[model samples]
Every structure is written in structure tokens, then in C-alpha cells.
Target: MINSKFVKQKEVSISVPPGIDDGQMVRLSGMGEALEGGVPGDLYVKIHVRKHPYFRKEGFNLVTEMEVKLSEALLGADKVVATLDGEITLKVPSGTKHGMILRVKNKGVPLGGNRRGDIYIRISVQIPEKLSKEAKKLIEELKKEGL
Candidate 1:
């Protein structure tokens, strides 16, 4: 019989092997017995396999990082896709500052009962990894102009 006081809390994903019946009584080795019964009782469990990538906190939106090209960052494009999901394009405004937050209402996590959360896009400026001679010369010219 499983002990009643041995239950532990878990936050991450857990997979139950196939052929497990729904509403079946089972206990983890460490998880204890169910209440009201001196003997061990079947432990209740809920299984969910997949989840979205973003984690949300109240009063704050969350999204993965995405780097914009120098021209894109300077000109400020209309939308930039998130790295985790390329199809989810987040809009950007002109003169967007680095780390600027763009909030999309109701584009976030599901709060149940048909309610949803928000999504935020953080702007990032990207620099070229390897600069061609012409690019380097342009940078030098810009430096001369104190730009």
C-alpha cells in the first residue's frame, strides 16, 4: 500500500505509459494514500501531452526572442516572426526602440471559459556576423559623419 503522506507536487510534463485506463486508481511509489481511507486508495491523475512554448505572468506578456536585420531594425518593418513559431508574426512600429514591447491582446494563453492572455514582442537589433569590404567602408563613412 502507498503511504498517504508521500505525495509530491510536479510542474513539468509527465507521461503515463499507454494502456492506462482513465479514472483508474494508481499511486506513485512516493505518493501516499488518498484521504478518508486508512488503507491506500487509488490516486487521481490528469494527463496532458503538449503545451505552448510561452510562459505567461499576470500583468505581463511573454514571447520568444527574434532578431531583426540592421535595415529592418532601422526602417522598422510591420511585423517580425517569433523564433519558436515562425508563423506568428508580431507587428512593429516605426521608431521602435530596442527591447520595446508590443502587446497583442487576446493572443496569449487560454485562461479557460473562453478567456485569453496577451502576447508581447521585444525588439532586437541585429548586426552582421561577417562584414564585406563595402559594408566596412560604409561604416567608416558613417563614423566620419558622427552618425
Candidate 2:
């Protein structure tokens, strides 16, 4: 509550609706200043959503980046991803490229009723900085094989 010359300062708890966007307003009737003979005005509260450390919101969907090893990108591997609900195992298909997006259904923001959005996982392949001699030789062989 803000101190105002017309309205009295009083704290009130307001329940925000789920999946509400930032800068959206929530109106509370009869929560504002009371006139001499008129009804009380409505109070509007603007919402501001804090940025998450990892997840980014798009509509109701949540997007996040996951780093995978080069070998894992080449060969299929099971990867664990953190969602708003919890951690889930995602299968990375073989030959998965960098920036590949994998969608996990029903793991995103909750819509009205029992419906929910999905989570998109952006894949980031991490290549080895240094390689052993044998590893380098195998890579050279792969290069010769048009890899």
C-alpha cells in the first residue's frame, strides 16, 4: 500500500492469477479511496515477473539451454533437464545438432484448468578443447571418411 493524501494506507493481500504476464494489472474492487458519498474506487496492481536463472518464458512455454558433449550429440544419449515441475530425462537423438530444440509436453506454464504448455530445450554441443593423440588420430580418420 502506498501513502496517499486521499486514500488511507493499508496492506492487503491479493492473489495473482497463474501465467500472468509482467506489467499486467490486477484490479481489486472497493480497495481504493472512499469518497464522501460514492463507492470506493478500484485498486489496480501492476505485476512484475522476475527473471529466472535458466528458464525463459515464451507465451506459456518455457525455453532453456542444455549443454551436451560432442559425443553425446553424435551418438544418442539420455539427458536430464530441469523444468518448472522437476527434472526429467530427455532422449537426445543421434546426430543431434547444436541449437536443436526438443519439446517436452506439459512441462511449462500452467494454463487455466488442467492444460499446460510445453518446455523447449535448446541443445548446445560442447566440443573438447584438447584431445589425446589417439583421439586426434581417430578424428583425422573421421575427417578422411567425410565426417
Candidate 3:
């Protein structure tokens, strides 16, 4: 709650709505300097939302990224990802490539009126910097098989 001092020492209450974007302003009517006849001016309250650690806002949608192992990219794997709701298991398709996008429905910011946005997850495949001798042999075998 904020106290605003208008003319005649009158105070007004302003409530900011949720899901407001940064640099957006909320206007309060008749809460500014008063005119001669007791008419008041309007007051604008600017809003600022702090950055979130795990998510970013794009319009009404949310975006985040998750890392997947190289083996998971070759073969399908189930991954538990963090969303607005909570941690949920998502199916990482077999042969999924790096920088693939996965969508989680209705897991974004609130849009009001009982509506919400979606969350997009970018898959980052972790490549092993140094492959073991056995791992290199297996990769060569798979390449020979045209996989």
C-alpha cells in the first residue's frame, strides 16, 4: 500500500494488478493536485517486475531451457522439467537434436480471466568433450551401420 498526498490532504489507495509488465503504469483517477473547484488531477503509478531466475517472459508466453545428455538425444528419454506449475516429466523424443524446442501447455504467466500462457523449453544437448575408447568404438560402429 502507498500513501499519496493530494490536495486538501486527501489520500487514495491504489492496487496494482498482477502479471503487469515492467515499465507499465497504473493510473489512479482524481488522485493528483486538486483544481480550484476541488476537481483533482490523475496520478500514474509505474510498475516494475523483478526478473525471474528460471523463466523469461515473451509477450504472455514463457521460455526456458534444459540440458539433455548425448545418449538421451540418441535414444528417447523422460526428463523432469521445471515449469510454472511444478516439475513435470516430459518425453524427449528419440534422435532429438540440439536446440530443439519443446512446448508445455498452459504453464506460463497468467493472462487474467482464467487464462494462462504456454511455456517453451529449448533442448540443449550436452556433448562429451572427451570420449572414452569404448565410446569412440561404439560411435564408429553406429556410423558404419549408417545410423
Best candidate, lDDT-wise?
2
Q: TM-score: which candidate is best?
A: 2
Tens-digit lDDT string for candidate 3 (1-147) = 898654365566778775689999999987776756888788888888889998999988999998999999889899998877789999999989999999988778888888888999999999999999999999999999997
Instruction: Provide the lowest-lDDT 10-residue window in model 2.
Output: 2-11
- Candidate 2 Cα outliers beyond 4 Å, as residue runs: 1-7
**Each model's C-alpha lDDT?**
0.58, 0.92, 0.88
Q: How many backbone clashes does candidate 1 have?
A: 3
TM-score of 1: 0.51
What tens digits encode model 2's per-residue C-alpha lDDT throughout 8-120? 57989999988889999999998877778989889999999999899999999999999999999999899988888778899999999999999999988999899999999
Q: What is the TM-score of each candidate against the true structure?
A: 0.51, 0.90, 0.80
Report the C-alpha lDDT of model 1 over 1-147, residue by residue, as the tens digit.
975566557664344653233344444543446556566554456644343454334432446555667767666676645432235656565556678777777655555565666666666777789999999999899889986
For candidate 2, the per-residue lDDT at 57 reads: 93
Rank ordering of all candidates by TM-score, starting from the highest? 2, 3, 1
Clashing pairs in 2: none
